[model samples]
Target: MSVSNPTLITFVIYIAAMVLIGLMAYRSTNNLSDYILGGRSLGSVVTALSAGASDMSGWLLMGLPGAIYMSGLSESWIAVGLIAGAYLNWLFVAGRLRVQTEHNGDALTLPDYFSSRFEDKSGLLRIISAVVILVFFTIYCASGIVAGARLFESTFGMSYETALWAGAAATIAYTFIGGFLAVSWTDTVQATLMIFALILTPIIVLLATGGVDTTFLAIEAKDPTNFDMLKNTTFIGVISLMGWGLGYFGQPHILARFMAADSVKSIAKARRISMTWMILCLGGTVAVGFFGIAYFSAHPEVAGPVTENPERVFIELAKILFNPWVAGVLLSAILAAVMSTLSCQLLVCSSALTEDFYKTFLRKSASQVELVWVGRAMVLLVALIAIAMAANPENRVLGLVSYAWAGFGAAFGPVVLISVIWKGMTRNGALAGILVGATTVIVWKHFSLLGLYEIIPGFIFASLAIYFVSKMGAPTAGMVERFDAAEKDYNLNK
Candidate 1:
C-alpha cells in the first residue's frame, strides 16, 4: 500500500503535464469548431494516435489483458475482430467521411452530420443521434472511470471511493480547460506511454520467466486449455467476437479523429500509422496477460493469493517485476489509457449537448465563446454521471465497455456506413435504423436471448430496418441532389 515518494512524484508530474497541455490548448480554442473538432486541423500523426488512444482506452490495458489471463487464447478473438474492423473503417469509411462531413454543411459533430447528410428538416435525426451518443457514451465513459479506480486502488492503495474521484479529477480538469485539441494532444502523448508500457511489460515478464518456451511450459502445466484456441469453439461465439470490429464504425470518439483530420490525403497515412500502432499495442497487451499466467504459475507467492479478478494480473506483475520508480511510470500508462479515453468521451458528449442540443434548441444565437463555456459545463456534468455509475468497485471495465460498444455499434454503425455509401438512404430509414438498433440492443441485453452478444442481432435488425424503410419511402429530390454532391466530392478527392 505504501508508494515511494518518487513514485508519487512521478504520478503528480504526469497529471500536471496533462493539465498544462489543456491550458496551452485553451488559448487557441476560439469557437465551437476549435473546441469540438480542433478547427479540423489535426495532422496525420495526431489524428492516428488520438484515434488509437481514445478507441483503446483503459479496456486495452486492464480489460483485454484480464480477459486473456482469465480465458486464455479464446479472448484473442476480440483483438482479431478489432484489428480487422479498424482497418476497414480506415480504408472504406475514414476518407469518405472526412470529405463528406466537411462538404455536407461543415458539420462539427456526428449528430450535425446526420442531420445535414439526410436533410432532416424536422430535426428528429439530430435529436435521436445525439440522445444515442449521450446515453451510450455516459456508460462508455464509466468504464474508463472503473479502470482508473482500479489502477489507483491497486497502485496507491486508496479506497475505491477516493480513487474513483481522484482518478476522474485530472481528466475532467484538462478536458474542461481545453476541448478537442487538449484531448487530441494528450491522447498522442498517452498513446506513446501506453505503447511503451504495453511493449516493455511483456518483454520484461518474459525475461523474468526465463523465456517464452519456459513461460509456455509453465502456463501449459497450470492448464492445458490456456493454449487451446478452440477450447470453447462455437459459431455464434466466433461471430460475436468478430462483431466487435463493427463497433469501430459507430464509435463517435474515433470517428471524430477522422472528422478532424487536416485533409482527406492525411487519412491514408494516418490509417497506416494507426494500424501499425494498433497491432503492436494489441499484441503486447495480450502477451502481458498470457505471460502473466506463466509468471504467476511459477511464482504464485508474488500474487499473494488467487483472486477472481484476473484483471489485477497486470498491476501485480508490474509491482513485482520492476523497481518502484519504473513501476510508477508503467502504472501511469494505465492512468494514461483511462484519461485519454475519458477525455474524448466527455468531449464527444459535450459536443452533443452543446452543438446538437443547446445550439439547436435553446441558444441558436449564442456566441462562440459562450457555447465553449457551456460545453465545459456539460463535460463536468457527464463526468459526474459517469463517476456515479462507476461508484461500485465491483463493476468490471470490460462488461461496461462491451455493453456500450454494442449499443453504439448497433445503433449508429450501420446507419453511418449506409448513409455515407448509399445515396438512397432516406431520413426515415436513418431514424428507423437508429431507433431499432438502440431498442434491440437494450432489449436483447436485458432479456438474454440465446446467450448471443446483443450487437449481432441489433446490427442485423438495424440494417434490415434501414433497407426496408428506405425502400418503403422515397428520398426527396433535394436529398438525392445533396447526396450526389457529397458523392461527387468524395470521388473527386479520391
Candidate 2:
C-alpha cells in the first residue's frame, strides 16, 4: 500500500481526460468506415503517431525497459531492428496499401482486400484471414491487458484481477465510442506524451544519481554484464530477440492504418515523423531502465522491491522525482501507451470479425446498421476473452506479445511481401502460406520440436512450404489473370 495521495489524485485526472477524449472522438464517427478508418482522412502526424504508438504499446513501456534492466546495452538492438522495420513498412507498404486498397473498391479490412484484390469470389481467403486475425489478436490483446494489470498493480497497489477489468473496461469504452478516429487521434496525443515522459524520466533519474559518469560507473559496479552489449545473450538469443521486427510485415492493426491513409503522399512525411518518435521514445525508455538499475543501486532503500520488477522502474522513478502533479502526468504517459494500443487492436479485431466473418460468412445480407452493432458486440466479446486470459498476472505479457507478433509475421509476412512484388502468387500459395506459417508458429511455440530451432525455424519452414507448394500446383487461372493485371499497374506506379 504505497499509495501517495498526490499520485492517486493524478491517476483519477488522467483517466477522466482519456474518457473525455474518447467521447469527443465519438461525435465524429458516422459509420463503419468512419469508425474503423476515420473516413480515410487522416493527416501525416496522426498517421505517424498512431502507427508508432500502436506498434510500441506495453512492450515499449514494460518489455523494452525490462530487457534493458535485465540484459543492458544489447537490448537496444531490438529498438534498432524495430525502427528499421517500421521505416521499411512505411516506405514500401504504406503508399501502395493506401492506393491499392482504395482502387480495390476501398476495401477496409486485410481479409477484405486479400479476397477482393485477387478476385477470390468464393470468399475463402477473407474468411480464413479474418479467423487468423481474430485468433492471434485475441492473444495479442490479452498481452496488453496483462500489461495494464501490471501497471495498475505497480503504480496503484491494486490487485491484478481488479486492475485487469478496469483496464479492459476503460480501453473498450473509449474504443467503442470513438472508433478508429478516436483511437488514432488519442494515439497521436499519447505518443507525444510517451516521448516526453521517456526523455525526461531518464535525464532526471541520471541527474539524481550524480551524473552520467556516476550512473555508468554504478551500473558497471552492480554487474559487469550490464556494461557489455553482448551481455548474457548468446548469438541465438540476440537474433531471436532482435528479429521481432519481422512481425511488422503481417500486423493487421499496423497495416490497416497504412491502408486507411488519406493519401500516399502522407507516408513520406509520416515516415520521417514516425521513425524519429520511435527512436527517441524507445531509445530513451531503454536508457531509463539502465539508469534505473543505477538509481536503485545507489539508493536501494528508496526503490523498495521495484528492482525485481523491471517494468516498475518508471513508476518508481516517478515516485522519487517531481511533485505529485508531474508524477501523475508521467504515470498517464505509461497508461497512454497501454490504452492507445489496446484500443486500436480491439477495433481492428472487431472489424475483422464483423466484416470478414459475420457479414461475409454468417450473414451475407447484413445491413450497415446491423453490421455496426455486430462490430460493437464483437469488441465487447473479444475484450472479455482477453480479460479472462489476463487474470493471471504472472504470465509474461512480453513473451505473449512476442509470440503473437512472430505468429502474425511468419503467417502473413511472407505472403504479404510476395503479394506486393511477385505476380505469380496464387490463391493456393496465399492459402498455403497462411496455413503453413500459422501451423509452424503454433507447433514451435508449444510442442517440443524434434531437434529443430525455435523462432526462426518456424519462419524458415513455413516460408519454404508456401514457396514449394505454389510451384507444384498450377496457378488458379482466375487469380493469375487478376494478379497479373494488378501487378502490371502496381509496377508501373513504382
Candidate 3:
C-alpha cells in the first residue's frame, strides 16, 4: 500500500500545469464563442490531439487495460475498430463541419448548429437534442470522475469519496475559468503524457521480463488463452463491443474540435496526427495489459493483488517495476486521460444548458456577461449531479461511459451523418431520428426484454425511425427548394 514520494511530486506538477492553463485561458475569454470554441482559431495539432484525448477518456486507462488484463489479446480488436471508425469520421465530417459551422456564422455549440442548419424556429429539435446532451453527458462525466477516484484511491491511498471530489473539483475549477482554450491546451499536454507513459511503461516492463519471447513464454505457461486474440471471443459480443467506435459519429466534444479548427485545410493534417497518436497509444495500452501477466507470474507480490481488480493493472505495474519518478509520471498519464475527458464533458454540458436553453428560450436577449455567468453556474450544477452519481465509487467506468455513449451515437449519429450528406433530409426526419434514437437507447439500456446491447437496438430503431418518418412526411415546396439550393451551393463551393 506504500507509494513513493517522487510519484507524488510528479502528480503535483501535472495538476499545477493543468490549473495554470485554465487561469491563462480565462484572460482570453470575452464571449460565448471564445469560451466554448476558442474563437474558431484553434490550429490543427491542438484540435486533433485535444479531441482524440477527450474522446478516449478514462476508458483508455481503466477499461482498455482491464480488458487486456482479463480477456487478453481478444480485446485488441476494439482498438482496431475504434481507430478505423475515427479515421473515417475525420475524413468525412471534420472539414465539412468546420466549413459549415463557420459558414453558419459562429455557431458556438452543437445544438446551435442543429438549430441553425435545420431552421428549428419552434426550437423543438434544439431543445430535445440539448436535453439529450445534458442527460447522457452527466453520466459520461460521472464515469470519468469515478475513474479518477479509482486512480487516486489506488495510488494515493485516499478514500473513494475524497478522491472523487478532488478529481471533480480539480477538473472543473480550470474548465470553469479557462473554458475551451484551456481544455484544448491541457488536452494536448495530457495526450503527449498519456502516449509516452503508455509506450515507455510497456517497454520497460517487457525488457525487465527478459524480452518479448521470454515474456510470451512466461504468460503462455501461466494462461495459454491470454495470448489468443480470438480465444473465447464470439462474433456478436465482439461486434457489439467494438461497435463503440460508431459512437464517435455523434460525440459533441469530438465534433466541437472540428468546429473550432482554424480552417478546413488543417483537417487533413489533423487526421494524420490524431490517428497516429491513437494507434500508438492504444496499441501500447494493449501491450502493457498483456505483458503484465508475464511480469506478475515472475513476481506476483510486487504487482500487488491485481486479480481482484483488472483496472489497476497499469498502476500495479508502475508500483512494482519503475522508480518513483517514472511511476509518478505513469500515474499522471492515467489522470491526464481522466481529466481531459471530464473537462470536455463539463464544457459540453454547460454549453447545452447556457446557449441551447437559458439563452435560446429563457432570455433571448441575455447579455454576454450574463451568458458567461450562466455557463459557469451550469458547470457547477453538472459537477454536483455527477458527484452524486459517482458516490457508489465502484460503478464500472466502461459501463457508465458506454451507456451514455450509446445514447448519443444512436440518436444523433445518423441524423448528423444524413444531414451532412443528403439534401432530402427534412427537419421532421432529423427530429424523428433524434427522438427515437435517444429514447430507444434509454429504454434498451434500462427496460428492454431483448437483452441486446443498447446500441444495437437503439441504432437500428433510430435509423428506421428517420427513414419511415422522412418518407411519410411530405416536404414543402420551399423546403424542397432550400434543400436543392443548399446542395447546389455546396457543390459549387467545393
Candidate 4:
C-alpha cells in the first residue's frame, strides 16, 4: 500500500490499534477461562456493542446494502425480520442462556453447555455440536475473509489472491494472541466505527442526490416498482426474506456474547442498548442502498463500479463522495466490520476444537496453560482453513453467511430455546433435533426445494424432532432437578 494514499494509511493505523488492544488483553488472559470466555466478566456496554458488532459482520455494510441496491425495498423484508428476531433473542434467550450455562457447569462452549445441561454421558452431543460448529464456522469465517479481501482489493489495488491473505492477517494475529477478550474488546470499537459509517454515508448520499424528492423521482423514472415492497415478488419470496430472523436464535457467536455477560442483570440493560444500536445501523444500511438508486441513476458516469458489483456500492460511494482523509476513516469501518466478526468467529471455532474436542478427549487432565495454547493453535489452524476456503475470488459474502447462519440456527436454535424453557427436554431429543436440523438445511439447500430459505425448514424439522423424540421417553429425575434449579435462578435474576 502507498504511503501517499490516505485510505490505506488509515486502514494500517486502525489494524495496528486492534493488534495493540489484543496485546494488552493477552497480559490479562491467565487461563483457558479468560481466553475462551473473558472469565465471564463483560459489562453491559461491552456486551451490547460486541454482540451487535459480531452479529452484523460485513453483511451489514456490504451484503445487505448490495441486496437493497440490487432489488430496492422489496429486499427490505429481511431488515424487518432481523429487527424483530434480534429483539426477541435478547428478551427470551439472553437471560436464560446466561443463567443456564453458568448454572449447568460454567460451560465455556456451546458443546460444553449442551453436554452439561443434558448430562450427555456418551459425549454424543458434544461431538455433534462441535462437528457442526467446525463445519459451519469454517464457512462463516470465509465470508468475513472474503469481505475483507474485497475491501483491500478495491482500496489498495491488490490482486484477489494476495488480498485474501493480506486481509486475514491482522484478524488472525489478534485472535490467536488474546482470544475472546481481544475479540470482544475490538468489537466495541468496530461497532462504533460501523454505525458512524452507516449513518454518515447515507445522509450525504441523500443530500447529493438532491434530497429525498429528487431521489425518489429518479428512482421512479429508473424503475417504477422500486418503491413497492411487494413488487416483483411472490408470497414465498417475502416469507423467505423474513425467515432470516429465525436464524438469529441459533447463531453461536452471538450466543457466546450472552454467555459471556457478567450477569443476567447486565443482560437486561444490554438488550436495550443492543437493539437500539441494531435498529439504527440497519436503518442506515437501507438508506444507503435506497438512496444509491437515485444517486447512481442521475450520475451513471460514475456508476459502472456499482453496476458491475453491487456489493461495492458503499465502498465506491465513500471514495467518490468524501475527501481522501475522510474517505480513509469511512473505509476503515469496512475493515473494522470484517475484523470484528472474523476474530470472534475464529475464537469460537478455536474454543470448540480445544474445549470440546482436544481437552475432552486428547488430554482429559490437561492444565489450563496447555489448553490455552491449544486454543491459540486451533485459531491459527481454523484461520488457514478459512483463508483457503476464501481464496476463490468468486465467493459471495451474503451466500456464504446465509449457509453457515442456517446451519447453526437449525442445528442449535431449537435445542437451545427448548432446553432453557422445557425441563422435559431429554438428551435423545436434543440429539435428534441437531441431526434433523442440520440435515434438513443441507438437503434443502442442495435440492433448492420450495424456493424457500433453508433455515425455515431446518428450524421447523429440528423443533419437531426434539418434541417427538422427547415424548417417546421420560427425562431422568436428575435432569428435571437441574432444569428447575437453573430456572429458579433465571427467574430470580431476570
Q: RMSD in Å for candidate 4, one decimal?
A: 0.8
Q: In what order do the candidates fall by lDDT, top score first?
A: 4, 1, 3, 2
Give the per-residue lDDT of model 4 (tens digit) for 192-287.
999999999998998898888888999999898888999888999999889889988888999999999999889989999999999999999998
Tell me the whole-model lDDT of each prediction, alpha carbons only.
0.92, 0.80, 0.85, 0.92
Q: List the residue pairs that clash in candidate 4.
A: none
List candidate 2 segments past 4 Å from native. Answer: 1-4, 448-455, 473-494
Local accuracy of candidate 1 as per-residue lDDT tens digits, 30-81: 9999999999999999999999999998889888898898889988999999
Query: Native-vs-model 2 lDDT?
Result: 0.80
Q: What is the C-alpha RMSD of each candidate to the true structure, in Å?
A: 1.2, 2.4, 2.1, 0.8
Q: Candidate 3: where is the Cα deviation over 4 Å?
A: 1-4, 447-451, 474-494
Candidate 2 deviates by what RMSD? 2.4
Candidate 4 weakest ten by summed lDDT: 1-10
The TM-score that candidate 2 achieves is 0.94
Best by TM-score: 4
Which is the better candidate, 1 or 2, if ranked by lDDT?
Answer: 1
Residue 476 lDDT (model 3)? 59
